[model samples]
Target chain A: MKKYNNIADKLVKSSIANPERIYNYLLYISAAFFSVLIIFPFYFLFVVSITPQHGLAEVRYLPTGFQWENYIDTLEIVPLHQYILNSIIIATITTVFVLIVASLAGYVFGRFKFKGRGVLLVAFLIITYFPGTTYIIPLFRLFTGNISLFGLATPDLYGTPWPVVLPLAGITLPLATFILTVFYSRIPDGLEDAARIEGCTRIGALFRVIVPLSAPAVATVGILTFILVYNEFFFSFLLTDSSYNNWAPLVHGIQMYEVTTVRGSPYHLMAAGSILGLIPVTVLVFLGQKKIVSGLTAGALKE
Target chain B: MGDVILENIVKQYEDVTAVENINLNIKDGEFICLVGPSGCGKSTTLETIAGLTKPTSGEITVADREVTYLPPKDRQIAMVFQNIALFPHMNVHDNISFGLRLRNFDSKEVKKRVENAAEILQIKEILDRMPDELSGGQQQRVAIGRAIVRDPEVFLMDEPLANLDAKLRVHMRTELQRLHKELGTTIIYVTHDQAEAMTMADRIAVLNKGELQQIAPPLKCYNEPANQFVASFIGSPSMNFIEGKIRSGGFESTHINVDINIGNYDDLSIGDPITLGVRPEDVYPKSNSPEIQSQSDPIDAQVDVLEPMGDEIFVYLRLNVGAEDGPTVTETSSADQLLMSVDPDSDVSTKDNIELVIDREKLHLFESGNGNAITHGIGEQTALNQNR
Candidate 1:
């Protein structure tokens, strides 16, 4: 035991003397480990996506043979293009709606001093804490026109794109508003004052100075909202019918593969559909990776 | 044409009064510096004049036009802030011409004016560089350039050089003085640094605790401070204040006594509390008393500390006259210490017992109750009494 203690002390001292080199080696090893951990599932999904359905039992680390027709089969089995189009439209509309409303709400809550501002901000925060399932029944009733507001009948938007777009935008707004509020508030007040002194109105300063400086946060909110609405399953599945024309999103379309297959579950086709669905989100994240990182980390440290 | 006037300006926020009943009448092309310690309402006073902050009740006029309620842009004024609030997204040219472009000036005219401002500031070469790429001094110059291109009647600056390095601050002081000379605009500068005000301002308006103390030339403020606050605040080492009371014979305090004649002023009565203020330079060793024409009697002191600068040495002297028996001397109280500035070459060291005398011609007396000036140059008052 005494001899072991001496060796451990020598090892500790050596590492401490050249800590940076050891630290770098440990950093790279752990980073590479995490990279593999994150990438392995996606890699497996892609390998399974192109493997033939009959070869699944024999499949190990690699696919036995390429079955490129699985992608074609996945598209033909369901109206995947129509679902993709529907998802695109819904995500775009939801993202735009959330951005516009959140930016305004964020600017007001962040900059202006008014009565009940704290209460209102806390109320928005509370809305974010409640899960979507908790409010789905009431939202379904409201959209189907069963729940009237102020003695006026709510519009029947059950099977249309509005049902999915509006609620998703509403669901995403609080978090987006939170990000924007924190980002906008961190900007020096002097910039707005300078703008006003230079002949800009309050709103002009918002667009010209505040909004331009907040591009990273805005892109962050946009990408998150787009990906969320694109892949939303429960709400879109419940709100809209299974008809592709009725604006069922890609997630709903992917779920269709489980039931509509004639034989035992065609897992390859499902994998192909899921892989194809990830393209848009993948491209968006790649494009806005820097912005999202900055947006999340901004205001965490003081200038 | 750009005379600025602020009448009865008062600003109160909830419980605190930022500035109260402030009035200033600035002449055209005058460089006036509003200077004070932090939270002294100097910046608040300047903001009210610039129309950035509305005074609770006051009237302001710029260029002979009443602009009390007008917005800052409509008041024909441009302000430079302490943080150098240049839009970080814009390059130097765009930042300087932001106001011009907002007003929808012809593109050609805006270009010409930006170029002219750049030339005036001598930053013409870096017009295309971003704000973060510029050094601190360059960023401040860009801020000033932004103000100058507006061609407003009054230019308000709020501690624009407070962020620069000490050497750069000194350099910008001369540059700002030159700018004031060339522009001839009614520039109202605000800073907490008295040295900056003393060097650049034609008139320095000293404020303390939301009240304007005095507005006078730099030398007048130094030589004849309007009150004790003005006296202590305007000078670098600060004027030494010795609290005492007026007796029938003269002024009496714990450490020393001075014979001041009360017959010269009707307001002063026997037993009235007074404060004696004398600058560090007015204090001298007893050996130089023969060269001084009107000097006070020697006061015994022991040197506490010595700080020798290139030109002079600041000798902190602990008055030994009353410290052993006086009730005011405590471990923390600085009231018993006097700061004296002697010639740098003078052989003064710590802990040396010495006798010092103040120049009577530069002595200032203030009423302790209201901190108002009672008299300057007590020697002249005594001389007048003797002549009579």
Candidate 2:
């Protein structure tokens, strides 16, 4: 028994000398794989954008030669500058509207314990579970009808920015609301109670105390909504026509340039449009990355 | 101007009664600690007094004003939370000045009050620091500072020191007492810790199961606990309870025989089952020592365990003698034990057969059925004080 105890003690001490070596190697391998997997698409997009239009016939992962004119030429094919500005305007307005609606809705859902609160929140969640394209035909009819459910006089919203803005806000509202509500609930209502006792009204407490403390969550919601709206293709494609190309988002503009002929794809111009479309979101995420990360992981840290 | 009164406050939810008919009057500038176990509605009582939650059927009059239906903002009160809910986004200065600014106090006045509060809490250097940057004690200090700056009639604190380390909690307890003296504000503090209640409260309101148990000065509540719950809850190493009956003219326990002369009471009669209660300090080991040998016969018990806490040792002695011929006194359950707090310097060890005697005057007799004390000492001049 004494000899067996000594052997076990020696085994433990030897294992301690190389603590978690296998775990470290496995972590390093998986991290490298994930980084390559994430970076490969962006690299592919950039390679295809700068590759020569003539060199497209050759089978290659890397660009053979730079066709810098394809960047300028893609603008002519689809009015890419106008489309980029339109996408930016649509995404920005939609994000702003969604944030206002979602914050108020999220605060109500998170903090208040009214009757049917769980049912209401679950109903909102059910809206997100359904694909956004399922109600497109009815939404189009509602906005474009002379007899409007929105109580408008001879309303036709197809050619206007309202059609795009309204649907985008609708799609983004549920997820933003979900994120903000979860974050808001993590914040103890005691803070608001403290504020209320400090001479602030309930609404005043909501604005002054709860909103200020919710900056990380707000950033999370804003970034997620912006990225979704900026890259939104199906709704922007289906909701608006080519005559209203001035209001078309960048995703719709990029899809207009896609031509699959027997020769080859216009991988160069499409990739250029796609990269231009990616800039706003990349800049936004770069700016608010810290807040976004902490916001997403807020409730996981108990303290 | 902070005299607060709750008249029959009853708060009932759909499935549970949070607080039931609690009537308490807190005088102006008194530091009252509401101590109870969790879910005892101590916090609910404090919240209802603060106007944060309305009682279902009650009248609350604070500073002689009927604030029963008024919102929290209309009521002149401030509160600190157990979690120390300092706004994470704001620095200490902003956190302290939040209320003043919201009420549209001028910037200069807000700054003056904020700085004044910072001076009191001794956190002036960290005024610009965010709450996350501060330590737990400093953050709680800032929370108290936030409450003090408002200068409300009443300050409601819900377990404000529960998060700090032990040393910091003690330090903050003294600091809170000093602040209470300096400010002279009515404070309704709630905590689950009986030691905090004993140490700082001018008066402690003991509660159990959504009902108020007793409200009295600390030693009054300690020495004369109103019921079985208050007796058990208010002391460290709790008072031992032995079950038996009152027969002939003395108190009796089933397992041991230490005769004590229990006087006559109105409702207590002969052959009535009684619970015998005694503090650990009252039970002493019998020896040739004159100071410990008392009026009663020495009952032999075996020392089961010894817990030495610095200057004192808690001796757990059980009745280890073989069964005698007197009916075994009804039951011989496992908890038939006696506890004695002796000096740590005393020579005693586990599993030793030692003779014991209890201070007859310090014994507590409670009715076994409802735990009402048939006869209890008022604790004005306790045996512990004489020993000290």
Candidate 3:
């Protein structure tokens, strides 16, 4: 038993001594595997897009040559700048509206007790679970009828950004409120009590203490809101016409034109567009990367 | 410093009453401890005095001003909570001077008061440190310092020493007493620990089940409890209660009967059930067997458990008694078992049947039905003294 124990101890010591080297070797293998899984398709697309229109069929894993002029041709064929602007405006408006409405509702639901609080929460959940397809027909009729309020009348919303941004904002409200509620509830009650003792009224405590203490929670909500608003596709595609090209519609447009003979397989432009679309989100992820991981994992592991 | 008065204060929730008809008059600069078990309304009463809670019906006067409806911030009172509710984001100086800053004190004034409070608590070195950076004891000191700089009329503390370890609790208890003396602030502290109450209270108010049981000096409450609950609640290794019958001349039981020459209760009938309470120190070992006069009671009991506690052995004795009128005492006094403090060096063990003697003069008799003392003791004429 002693001899076996000595052997085990020696094995453990050697393993510990080269832990960093072993870790790096494993990481390198995994990184190579994932990179191939992700980057290969993009590489193939680049070769397809940039190769001369006649050389497309002979395209293999490696690019024959670069034909960067296809990007200018693709831009001329599509309203690329209009799509980018529409996407930015829609996403920015949705995120701002969703955050403000959700935080107020979240604060009330999280901290206050009143009649119908639970019922209101359940109502929000039910609205979230309600199928979006069920509203499409009613929404189509309203857009056709030019639904008007006291004075403000709805315009031709089918091809406008309003329909997409408005409905998407409403849909994101419940989820934003839900996430913020969970975040707000996790803030320690002691902080509120401390603020109360320090001569803070209820509103003062909420703004001065609870909000500051819930910074990580707000950041988590902000990042999730940005990502969700930025990536929403169903409303964007269904509501906008080809003239009003949003990012979601852009992706769809590229796919449709590539497969068709009108723009036979412009894979390189699609890959470059994919790469461009991935930049904002990738940068955002890096900026609040630590908070994202912490927020995501916090729900899994409790201290 | 301020005098606080609660007149017929009542706090009731939907289905439960937290504090019921509490009437207390606390003098200026007095450190009064409201001590009881959980759900005893001591903490609720303290919060009521701090104007943190609106009593269901009552009048609260602080410094002779009716302030029952006032908000806590306007009541000129500060509190230290059990959880040490210090602002985690604020530095120690900012936390201490939060109220001063809120009340719009000038920068120099806030700085001076914060520095003075930090110096007094010896936390000046950590003024720039956040609350989370400090240890539990340091956090507690900052909590107190925060309350101090406000210079509130009353310092309401709700079990402020409960979070510290045993050794630190003891140290903080002494510090609290010293602070109370130095600041001369009227403090209403609530705790369940009797030691904390006895050590620091100018007067300890004992509560049970939302009712004020008794309020008196520590020694007075310990020596002359108004009711059985106070007697049992105040002492460590609590007062032992024995069942017997109060008769003419003395008390009697199945195990043994005692004839005490009590000055009063001569007309008390025989066969009337009563309980006799005696402190552990009152029951001595049998080695010093003094010459018993004819009026003494000698009750012999078998030792059931022996607890050697350095200074004395806590000897658990079981009396051998059986009868139809066999005083049905509850498990708190199970089957004639008694705990007596004997000399530590005494060679006593379990299974040893020891003959013990009771000093009839020190015996306390209470009616079993109501648990009130049947006999009374002498009292002097003082403004704060209770009538006997």
Candidate 4:
């Protein structure tokens, strides 16, 4: 009787089929797996940045000893403070300029009816689809005044900060405009009409009513522009050569440190520079994650 | 001071004529409803009056001033939309006082006006709460409060109660009338519900296919429709139309042959196709009625369906004009089916054979081709006429 009872109990336990529970388990397992995959790099980066002077040559799962001097050494070797200030200036100006141009363009694209609206929108879409590097050669020639457009020589912008700021703003324009356009389109026309009837001109209504409501999209665009200009190295490298290192951004400065100081990859210093460089933007994204999420899912769901 | 007049108002979209030749005069403190089916240009007319849409060519005079080209803000018109349009991010107080603050009104006056509006809308305590926290009905009140604080000369509402539940809608209807009485401002309401138009508007303007069908008091439009479309549209279950021809100094058809007293309709002649219409209540089941037997020829019909409304029953009967037996009715189209409104206490069922009769004095005649009402009654009928 005891043996029969044990066998029946096993059969009854195995008979349970709950697809929902199974799906939940599968979801959790996959999510945990991917989470580790994504987080492992940052953990490794921190570990390498903290490895002691002699620990770089050791093969281990983690640093044997911690070194607090690497961060100080990185700042001392490279003019990290000056590079950070330069990056902040360029990213700030680019973010502001992109916001102004893209928001206005987005408003016009969203609400206005003019000839060639479709064609112009399609052109903007095509520009967004291509990688910015595709225009690198032409942009280099044009900025350096080496090319003529319609038989007119372009202005010389090779060594100044203008080339970096201008192209960064232009490259980021399409994304900002796309975000703001979708945000603007989701607003009901009735709201504008209500504002118009409530004693506001079109532009006044746009600033008073529409702008305040688009805080999430604006934050998203601003953050994206900041991150783009801050991490951008190619334009900064091409625009300002070694003689103009004063205008060199943070990433370009770090790249110079890697190339000039060491013959090959310096894992400890590279990890240390990357960790230090990502601090500001990581803080920003963490702070405004809610806004970014809302902006991305603006028209799809209610909340 | 809020009388509005539109002269030769024509609005043309790229390939569609939204409205054309719309001329209307809405007097001060009068409630006028522009009622029609969707895409009938009633909303276009209302929007034109509100200065939300520019007319291709017209002169819009509001409060004795031409505002044809003026923007909505300068026109002294405030509109309430169907969606309520309460700004989601702002609290009720801010949503209501935003316009005042924008205009640089003194804080004291803005506060006073907002308070007064809140009291009127009965949402004073919830002023600090965001819009999403409020119920749909409360949100609508906030929207109305926003419009009222502007104190515009003309109030335009485009189906303001359309989004509410039926019970709430009925309640809001009375509430709107009360508000109109208290404020006494010119209101132009647009809706597709004839019942709503009839209940609220002092004058109802009916439109069809972008053209005005009739503009008169609700009861006047109901009693004396200028065209067959208005007659059919103004009533529920619609006024029944029995197509026949003028013959032998009366009317004749395969399913129904009745002697209609048109009271000197001289233009009508024999062999002219005419459509006779009667309200459902005016059609009685003569042979089955417990009341005195009708002194008229019995109309042989078979009851197709019975719709039992609470107070009254709508009996749909198919007519028989020529058959081999007592119910000898000819093979006629389904349009020959007659609708009769009877008291709910009557004994009637689906598929029952019965004889019906139409009230002669309540008859209406229209030309078949153009749908022009040749003879129609004027003034209101009894309130308990069972018009459904």
Question: Which candidate has the top score in lDDT?
Answer: 1
lDDT of each residue in B1-388, candidate 1, tens digit only: 8999989988999899999899999999999999999999998888887777889988899999999888777888899989888887788999999999999999999999999999999999999998877888888999999999989998999998998889999999999999999989989999999999999999999999999999999999999899989999988899999999989867888776777778877878998999999999999999866788777778988888899888999998888544556333354257678999999889888778889988889999999988899888877336543443
Cα RMSD for predicted model 1: 4.5
Error of 3 at B85 (Å): 3.7
- Give the per-residue lDDT digits (tens) of candidate 3, residues B1-388: 4999999999998899999999999999999999999999998898888766789999999988899998777777889988887776677888888888888999998888888888888898998887767888898999999999989899999999998999999999999988998999999999999989999999999999999989999998898888788888998899888788866555676565666443435535777887878787666556555643322445776777788999988988777633334323352256377778877778888777567776554566777887887653321122222121
Model 2 clash pairs are none
lDDT of 2 by residue, B1-388 (tens): 9999999999998999989899899999999999999999999998898888889998999988999999998888899988888877678898898888878989988988988888988999999987877888998999999999989999999999998999999999999999999999999999999999999999999998899988999998777777778888998889988877766545566565444333435666668887777788877777734664343556778777899999999988767454454214344345567788998898999878788877666767777887766666422333442343
lDDT of 2 at A231: 77
CAPRI quality band, candidate 1: acceptable
* TM-score of chain B for predicted candidate 3: 0.90
Q: Each predicted model: what fraction of the native A–B Cα contacts (within 8 Å) does it retain?
A: 0.40, 0.55, 0.27, 0.40
For candidate 4, state the interface root-mean-square deviation in angstroms to 1 decimal: 4.9
Please give the distance, in angstroms, between residue A138's alpha carbon in candidate 1 and its true position after superposition: 2.0
Count of clashing residue pairs in every prediction: 0, 0, 1, 9
Report the C-alpha lDDT of model 1 over A1-303, residue by residue, as the tens digit: 999999999989989999998899999999999999999998888988999989877777899889999999999999787888899889999999999899899999889888998898889878878888999899999999998789998999988998888878888999999899988887778888888888887778888888778888889899989999998888888999988988899988887888898787788888899999888788878888765433332221113
After superposition, candidate 1 runs with Cα above 4 Å error: A1-37, A51-61, A70-79, A108-120, A255-269, A290-303, B49-75, B254-257, B284-306, B315-337, B342-358, B379-388
DockQ of each: 0.27, 0.30, 0.19, 0.28
True lDDT of residue A30, candidate 3: 100
Lowest lDDT 10-residue stretch of candidate 2 chain B: B378-387
Sort every candidate by TM-score, greatest first. 1, 4, 2, 3
Worst 10-residue stretch by lDDT in candidate 1 chain A?
A293-302
- Per-prediction CA RMSD (Å): 4.5, 7.7, 7.6, 5.8
